[model samples]
Target chain A: MTDRSRTPAENAELALLLEVAGTPKPGNVDRHRDLDDLRFEQFLAGSVGSARGLRAAADGAPLGGAFERAVRGMSRQSGGNTQFGCLLLLTPLVSAAAAGDLTREAVRERCRVTTVDDAVAFYRAFEHVDVAVGDPPEGVDALDARRGSDAEPALRERGTTLWDVMELSADPDDGVPDTNAAEWIEGFPRTFDAAEAVLADDGAVLDRAARSFLRQLAAEPDTLVATTHGESVAESVRERAASTLAAVERTGSLDPAEALAEAFVDEGINPGTTADRVAAALFVALERGLAV
Target chain B: MTDRSRTPAENAELALLLEVAGTPKPGNVDRHRDLDDLRFEQFLAGSVGSARGLRAAADGAPLGGAFERAVRGMSRQSGGNTQFGCLLLLTPLVSAAAAGDLTREAVRERCRVTTVDDAVAFYRAFEHVDVAVGDPPEGVDALDARRGSDAEPALRERGTTLWDVMELSADPDDGVPDTNAAEWIEGFPRTFDAAEAVLADDGAVLDRAARSFLRQLAAEPDTLVATTHGESVAESVRERAASTLAAVERTGSLDPAEALAEAFVDEGINPGTTADRVAAALFVALERGLAV
Candidate 1:
């Protein structure tokens, strides 16, 4: 989405900013909506600061440590969970870029090296913000970030790596499949595929992002929506998105998508999981030089 | 615009983000517009990075060196002039915050201590981005940053410190008074005044900013608009802004301002100087703890 001559760190920063600057992102903190307790500007600061920190430490730190540090930085700066989902998705991508490759294999390789200490730090970072992670699998409640430092000992005793946590969270057949978890476990299939989509599509980068977001929302109900609202609400939102995209196809305009976004916001339904996926997609697109 | 529980640095970052996030700014790369070369995301990245860098160095670095480093840091990340005017205004204000006093006197005292090396570094930073600066007064052609290193010796020989340059630029009665210069020379009267305005306003901070921006534009023709589009066009834009504000006053709504913004964007008119003033004002408001 920017000039290709920039460093990977610079592009990573740009990717984070673009992720927040996406207008009409509906109930999420896009340009149009600034929540009473949380401002969009705070999110902007957190995202940029975290992206820069991740890129700077990507080469030296293991994936889990880097991710924890980035998240901690954002929490300290923003005083909220402004971009926890984004940090989870972007950490490995930045690591891959620092490794001289931007590929799913590279990201997975980086994730494979995460240690138990990294998991402890990751849990510790959660004390700084109210990240919206749903309830964990029944037995793995010890892995819950909201458990704070209390979960660290069990994580240590189980020798449960960050990747193990991702694998558990990523099981699509499970009752709850986090978009971030799915990307981590499946070698970031959707992230890479979305990068390819951006390359194939023709328009401004923001417009492409909007289209990609709709496609993702139409394809599946958002996990965040399901968690915060309900399965029925999420399913209805997905169906509405599909119909809106179909209308866009018929009318060749985004007016329907805009209307759909307004309705989602009016209903207080935030497809945050899908928004996180779009951030990951935009990161991949920027990393691979998909935008001219 | 954000929770007051944040640190001064975090508040500074929020100010930068809020400044640029103002929507429908009309041809100035607000939320709705991204130029062919410069994206709104780049501006976001620039503002956040600069704010962070400024705050991080505020306690130790001399005001001039801090300003140069922040600008250089932004250039490294964004590769453009997204907030040159803003950096000029914020650096001194951040210094004041770091000095445990958020006052024009404190900022002036900070600027008064800048040396010749800071001046040279300031010019050196100019090489990294295409900042929009007007020509200097007579006998100061050698002070122009466009001359690059060629001006260094002259600056040293003339003993023209950064403060002296600010004094020259701050002459508000000058044919081309820089908004940044006016803040520096006049001890930031306008910035402080706008902060008072925000404190008195009864609404969302973003809406306060929108109203403050329109008022600032209506009060005076933006020098950036004058430099780029000539005095007559700038004056006409200011007149339209005045009329729009009058309509808003009559109707108690921003619809008139929105309509005027649409027309301004269509005509390629950007009141960038007013936008910079608004950023300075937001910084002052944040520094003074003016928030609901």
Candidate 2:
């Protein structure tokens, strides 16, 4: 609503801050709550620390390099991997925004054009923090991110672009959906859709973002939950989110959502991938003039 | 400690985040609470929006212009004037740090060198938000910040530099102290001292910042409280903070601080000036390699 214009980097950083500030986001760290190991302040620190990388992305730095730098900066906080997937999603979006087009098509085009060097840098980023990415399928063990820079040779030999790697991981036959990867191949459909939802909703912008996060969680099984637990557990979490969101809709209250948040935190069921997508959605919304 | 080195602008932005992230910061907006009008997310938005101004300062822009830009950006959030005083303190510090030294002497020199244009810019910044500055002295009505750019002629006619204006306002004959202005004249003593306290304290960095905030509040009456609710109320708030700090020191527990925070918020007493100093202190701490 204010007249101040923000650069792509500023909007990306704002998106990170707004996403974490949205309260009662089930199983994710928000302003009011934190998981046992990750405090809300760490998310704040991660958001601040990632500014350089965000700026670099906005300045049209290569996607993998920008994403890796952002992850490295984010890992400066004690709470590890605070926004790894978020940065992974935001980097390309920021680049697209910087290119004067923040559309899904622009981001998808950027993703499609990523090179082998970008893929190598993406793997190298894993050296900075412990991300719970589970094991790669048996044949692709050599390309695991945990190998860090050691996987660069495999990536180069196979001519695997970052986009190719994303496609490989997008929808595994094992039933564990990598939503972050899926966004790459699918033109970031969830992020764009969620941005539209955020713009359509009323009340505070952050409150709208919390609602958007819940909607996304309800619509899709969070990949982090699927990877850490099982597909069924992820599905059940989605169902819980759906019912909680329905109750909120029915009563015009977020109280039910808060209860669900508490239960999810207590159960240690973090829907981190959904949170990451919401962060990207926030960026899109901000770029499209969704006011604070 | 983080191995990554940060620019002055990055440190300043991180300081804003860390200060707000610290919980149980009595009478101020922190992670766990909000005032009736100002929400924690607004602070986050303000911090994100202020980055360009912070960067401008670090890049050696004129102090008043940089500060005005920062305040203008911060005002983009619906919560008006979220960090005006904090930005006022940080702009010169960032300029000093960008000059390859973050010492008190460096910042004081920067403040002393500010021009009348800077003073005009400072006044112009007032137009962007509703700052609760109360009334100026009878004769200085022409120079009141509420007059905005209209005060420029008076500033020019009197040859008043920003530093001169700050000195005029610092430690006024009236009981209410302008601590932010006093820092301009006194070489930022409180900010540096509190930075040392943050560095010496144990546990999380945010916990240290919260403790630092309490210590600062205990040591001096908050100027914002004095301005809003008279000097006696400010003094009483300081006494309460002192007692609460003593309880925390005696029991090695922050539980007492939480109760005091609830009481202070209920009473609608905000020690905003102290919070501003603490944010500046956090910037100093971060620049000196205090870990997140």
Candidate 3:
């Protein structure tokens, strides 16, 4: 029943919805659970609100402008930053798909061609919502996202393209990789791989997405988790995901994962970056003919 | 935090999402519950898929063509007929909104102006999914929705515009009013009134939507339920809803409604048509500055 002819913008929006609808996605808002502040309906509103920006990306708008517009739209909900990182990853991929190919090389080419204007617009997106980002590395204070549009002069003076900024943030000094930034630098390896995992799995598409999310989280520490908590907590969370996934694989039951979901929510350990990557993977899978 | 600047298409899409996300809606799919066949994610997919059709409606496409396209897109999900009635109600409202006004008069004018071609297209949409529609009157056998495109000649011969078709179906021979069709004939009174109820209520927006849904169901028998199950059963369902609403109002708790939700789902009594009206009401509310 998959509608493969859907526009890239439609697929991206579906990915966002599917990611949030996936159940027992430990520590993140899903169909069956909600955080204290962020409810599931807010995510639905965010996806609906972001449609214009997604269409803009598919129509070949500048990356920064599209992302900023999407972020601003997403923030229309009381839940401030429901899909900031997801939009960050999807905007370029949608553009790449709109360009006639969704290959890694195409995405890489798109990322590589980003201009300093794109970088400035990306910083401007930060002004729309409160994203929990770690501090910029030593000498890059002028490019901190918290500086918002105020950093535009410095970005122009340094001749920093969006690609250059991604490279700067791809590997942080604290040893926690900025997974979304790394996707830009490395052409979305995890996204493509997890998409394959989703296509290979069984059951509902959203359930498949939940498993892919667990796999992604198990494979690496979530950047948002590392930034919000600490590297140690992030690593432990990844280990928990790895163990929970292994148990589910052996038993063929989601019970263990569901229990872990409750514990993770209670502990306030949200692997949001991993969830974002899973959403990107879902878009890739859907675009490549994964059934709904 | 509501984005009042969203297009009519965007508001319609959000209304679909919000309608499905509302919890504890007896006998219908919601964020916390799914029917044996239809999951929450399919509704999400339907909303995502229907965006183009919604845009078409907002862009002044022929009403039948827009509704047919939206229904076709919605059927992309495996769960068939996820939002058929909703699209039926929303199509004209979106078109009215697009025509520089969302007033009841505007909607009435749009409905009254629907062409025979629009009636044919509306009939054609039935071919895309198996909707649970009642049989047409004896004299109107050739206009049965189950006849799909085969009824087109009859529609053209009778010079039946979409408005005329709604008028024929609005008050069934059985006394079970087709709420969605009734919306067309009466200029969407229940939709506008239920929207006011949603806006006047308190907690989460989805919860308010759920309450409004209950009020609508309590107020009248759901045409779909009456068609699938007997009119007596539909009347009983409405009585249960009324009592549940009264209890919830008296106790200031949703526990009774939640219990009723479980029983209604177990009995296989889905008030899908009433739910569709709630979605239209939600679209009206969202368009008229209901906060997210």
Candidate 4:
């Protein structure tokens, strides 16, 4: 395989960028040309520079200010909650991986990647990364591993779209007219479109993730308190997890097509998952907004 | 004050919106605007139509559907839980309030604004609507409420900014950088700045309130399963709450904030506040976040 073919990080970056550029017919648009047209040339260029720096650091390429150190420093500073910082680190890492500048194994060793396939990738990454990033739990993997154990769709191909997963249900109490499943589904494309716009504009995934994560975190009691100070972020997170699970259960009974986020929380809350303790709470809220 | 001026719903909307719009000029340009730079036009239009219809309805004047509904519906929806809808409802209401259409009594009835201040006059077609937005909880009123609760600086009055109340601290674990009180204060101006662009482009006080309310709700888990649906949402929420309280207790020592949250939760979970449960959780989070 060529250097490009050998590098998963490069592949991931291309895939992610392609996902951004692709939208409908990802390949049709001259993504490279529009990179500047959209005023994202700087972000893309910065990614490349950061990617090279990451690879140089990972390879121990006699680098000064290696990403590894940045990661370690950020992790410690976050009180081990590197979810926010990790994204900053990973955006570059993924780009490097896509550029054939870094090895997947190296990236995993530096961190850990149980599976990047829809189920495995999300669940594993959830566990491996810090809570401030995207902590997933250990038990949460049973569902994914069950699928992973069988291997049907390849990684990146299997995850369900927000539209496909969200199910609209009529609440017996919500007699007020207007909003419906169709309206809800319609909301998704718009929100995703908006999210994409925001992401492209602000390449700082950590800040975005922090915002996204906080959107969910803001659902639990004292989460605002916990967020300002990490002292009880995990606990507030856990409480949020339980609350979300219950909501999912309610929504599940109310709307069958809607994904029940409780299972993910169940998995995430399990201490064995490392970060599941925090992930359990976060995943549900994130999923709810995803449906939007 | 005219009898119409005494309407609580109108007063509440004016009080809250002006309070938000004037919030000591966090440096967010949105703070300086005519109709919040037109971001909440739809909502404002809706409320204005509601207000006109209301006057017509009160006077028993002949009116069109839009106007009639606007006049009739202003006081229909219960303000039990501020975030009753999926989207956290506050933002839309903010737009309505900012429009300054609803009568003072209407605003007062909804938000229960206590002080005898501009919230009443700001919205009236005439002056001195009998609106009295309520007083803040005892100690919370330590800051002179009568003097400067307005979101904006009164024509020439000097007042403390939201910056005065913010607090921050550094973390000793995980090496995450501490969030400083000064930094939060500093960030407020920037947040205000970013918010202004949105105010101009689309959102303002309503959006701010909605986001803030959503942030509060996001921290308070939603799925209250049993009564909500024949699901585990309530159970999950309860479990998470217990866990969160536990985490709060575990983190170093129990501060006054935890006690407040615990009190709210204890009351909310036991007999249950039902619709107000989310509000209870949010209040707990805000209080906890506000604790010194």
Candidate whose TM-score is highest: 3
lDDT, candidate 2, A1-292, per-residue tens = 3467778898899999999989889999997887899988788889988988998999999999999889888887778889999999999999999999888888999999999999999998899889989678668889887999999989989999999889888966554659899999999999999999899889887688789889999998999999898889999999999999999999988899999999999899999999999899999999999876
TM-score result, candidate 3? 0.97
Which digits, one per residue and each the tens of the lDDT, describe model 1 over residues A61-144? 766667776776676443377777877888878778766788788777777777788778778768767877778877677787
lDDT of 2 by residue, B1-292 (tens): 3356667898898899889889889988998888889988789889988988999999999999999999989888778889999999999999998888889998999999999999999999999998988677667888887999999999999999999879877855554669999999988999999998888889887788889989999999999999999989999999999999999999998899999999999999999999999999999988888976
Scored by Cα lDDT, where does model 4 land? 0.27
In Å, residue B279's CA in model 3 sits off its true spot by 0.4
lDDT of prediction 1: 0.73
TM-score of each candidate structure, all chains considered together: 0.86, 0.95, 0.97, 0.19
The 0-to-1 C-alpha lDDT of every candidate, in the order given, reads: 0.73, 0.90, 0.90, 0.27
In candidate 1, clashing pairs total: 0
Model 2 alpha-carbon miss at residue B159, Å: 1.5
User: What DockQ values do the models have?
Assistant: 0.25, 0.58, 0.59, 0.01
Compute the lDDT of residue B55 as modeled in candidate 4. Answer: 36
Ranking by TM-score: 3, 2, 1, 4
Positional deviation of residue A277's Cα in model 3 after best superposition, in angstroms: 0.5
The sequence of per-residue lDDT tens digits that candidate 3 reaches over residues B91-202 is 9999998777998988988999999999999998898888998878877789888998999999888899999989988976754568789899899999989888888888
TM-scores, chain A, per candidate:
0.91, 0.98, 0.97, 0.26
